[model samples]
Target: MNELISQAIAQWQLMHSIELVATLLALAYVILALQQSLWCWPAALLSTVLFTHVMWQSALLSDALLQLYYAGMALYGWWRWQQLKQGSAGSRGPVYEWPWQRHCWLIMATAVAGLALGAVMANYTHAEFAYLDAQTTVFSVMATWLVARKLVSNWLYWVVIDAVSIYVYAQKHLYFLTGLFMLYTVIAIAGYFIWRSHYQQQPAVRLSV
Candidate 1:
């Protein structure tokens, strides 16, 4: 057990600084998004760009495409957040609750979208692990959309995605990043419950204003 743990530690310690920086930015985005902060989209976009280059350089073509998708989502999310802003109240910006139903629909839609992307990737690009790649990308797109919409269940998708990402990263010897995703799993679970509880107390309202 000690040997195994030591090996894991050494492997992680050998990870490059660039990858470490990308993970930090990713985590920062998640934490900010969880707090319902509008800055999450832009911050997350920075991480996406960094990771895109990293993945492309590492020849993880599918992952590079995923980051490009994330870039697009970030733009949409930024716009969505602008709509959510209720203007500054004194010093702080106003915020509002989101309906849980939106999250449900988003998840369902993502599954369908993933199937379509998988078909295209399998037919055209030299995308390795085509189906799995498309699925993760699509799920992430949906999850990001939910976050942008201020939906409470966005973290639920993260919980699932992060779990899978950990194994995938480990298989590729990205031990440090695998550990980062593992840590994110705990945060995602906590965020899910916290946001759910908050959602429960919201009064009936059509719009978030």
Candidate 2:
């Protein structure tokens, strides 16, 4: 019994260390993202890589998959941001706003995709909050893409996503991650206003894009 308890304590310590490291990296990613710094992608890449393992260990399969996707997006976002910085061909310069109609269509498509993913996970896996997990994963994918594109509205999407994520992480007893998401919610709210200010300052030529 003592040996079993010792093993459990060691396991808990390991998990706690991993979660703490990932949480700090994720926090850095968000702060850099809000600043529109290229370094954010590298931070995100590292955080998601750690989180993929952490979420899998926690039995949050969809969340694990989302972290994998985030890892990929981190690479893409880095390249995309670099292109923008260099004023390369096909790069949309700086912060820009997308049409409301586009966002409406995007929301509908992702919502349907989330429901479908949730149904599959519910029927096939012993996943917790399958529907909710799928919804957050799908929307987060979209929001991450919007961030890569430098869309001003992505922060608004994150505000909602991060708020929901607090509940999700809390349910899993990931207190540190829940607190991180809480911070994410506040940062996202600030990011929206800050990005909007940047958008308003962009050159008229870029605004027409």
Candidate 3:
């Protein structure tokens, strides 16, 4: 395992040219979004475009497609969050959540979709470690939905997604990326608690309102 890790790090360092920077940029985007900064969307858009190219270079077509999803989501999230904020009628921020009912639906739907995606990847794709990749991909689609909604619980999804990506990237010898995911694991924990506290203060802002 140590030898493999070392080998992974060696190769990753050699390929650190553009992708590494894009990864860090993406991380910064998430950090800002966690802090409830709307600017994070545009900041993330740059990384997504950069990653599209980087993933193409790595021949990760699905992963590259993930960046395209990010682009679309970023636009949607930017618009949605802005409208919510503007609609706040004064000082209220738009950090509200989906009701628990909708939340459960998101989870159930995400699970079913993730399973279907995993099967397709496991059976029909050239994606490295296909089951895991597809699982992460589908989780991401769900997670992206949550983020767009500005649901505080999205941080919990981030933790799960990051945990899964750690193993996925590690196997692909993307050690730097794996390390970044480990950092995301830590950040997700912080983000969850932080967002939770924020939501607790604003419990009055349920989806109905």
| Each model's total of backbone clashes | 0, 0, 0
lDDT of 3 by residue, 1-209 (tens): 99999999987665675677878888898788878788889988888888787666665656777889999999998898788778775343656566678778777887787678767766676666655666677778778877888777788888988998888778767666788889899988998888778778764765623
Give Cα distance to truth, residue 202, candidate 2, Å.
Answer: 1.1
Best by lDDT: 2
Cα lDDT, all candidates:
0.74, 0.90, 0.77
lDDT of 1 by residue, 1-209 (tens): 99999997875554456688888888888788767677888888898887887677655576788899888888988887776565433221333455568557766888888888888878887766677767887887667666766666678888999898887778777665788899899999988887776666554435442
Worst 10 residues of 2 by lDDT: 200-209
- Which residues of candidate 3, in runs, are more than 4 Å off? 1-15, 89-92, 98-102
How does residue 126 of candidate 1 score in lDDT?
72
- What is the C-alpha lDDT profile of model 2 across 111-183, one tens digit per residue? 9999999998899998888999999999999999889988899999999889988999899999999999999
Ordered list by lDDT, greatest first: 2, 3, 1
State the displacement of the C-alpha of residue 89, model 3, in Å, after optimal TM-score superposition.
5.3
lDDT of 1 at 108: 81
Cα-based lDDT at residue 102, candidate 1: 57
lDDT of 3: 0.77
Candidate 3 accuracy as TM-score: 0.83
**Model 1: per-residue Cα lDDT at residue 169:** 76
TM-score of each: 0.77, 0.95, 0.83
Give lDDT: candidate 2, residue 137.
93
